[model samples]
Target: MNSTRRDFTELTMMSKEKWNDEELFYFQHALSQLLQYVNPEGLSILHEINREMHSRD
Candidate 1:
């Protein structure tokens, strides 16, 4: 993975245990908003985050 994805994944893992349902929901919503304005690389990161979050459900 690129540095962006690697850094994001690391951050997510570090915070994973601390996220409550509401926080996760808010994060997803924020990512969705960001997606609208980001480039393809950013979109990929958002998608990865979404997939990771969903897999936790």
Candidate 2:
């Protein structure tokens, strides 16, 4: 897997309490970007994040 996807996965696993609005925005941005590069397994993870992001709205 690419480092971009790896880092993004690690980021998602981390606690969100430290994430302010800007950080959270970047996390969402990273998820979108990673979706272009991920495999089937990674796609599932990103999709889950996408769902959570949408649900937050």
Each prediction's Cα lDDT score? Answer: 0.61, 0.58
**lDDT (10s digit) by residue, model 2, range 1-57:** 223333455666765543344555666676578777778866665566556556567
Q: Give the runs in model 2 whose Cα sits over 4 Å from its true position.
A: 1-24
In terms of lDDT, the poorest run of 10 residues in model 2 is 1-10
Looking at model 2, residue 31 earns an lDDT score of 59
Q: List, residue by residue over 1-57, the lDDT tens digit for candidate 1.
A: 223233344556655445555555655687788767877866765676576678787
* Best by the TM-score measure: 1
Model 1 spans > 4 angstroms off: 1-26
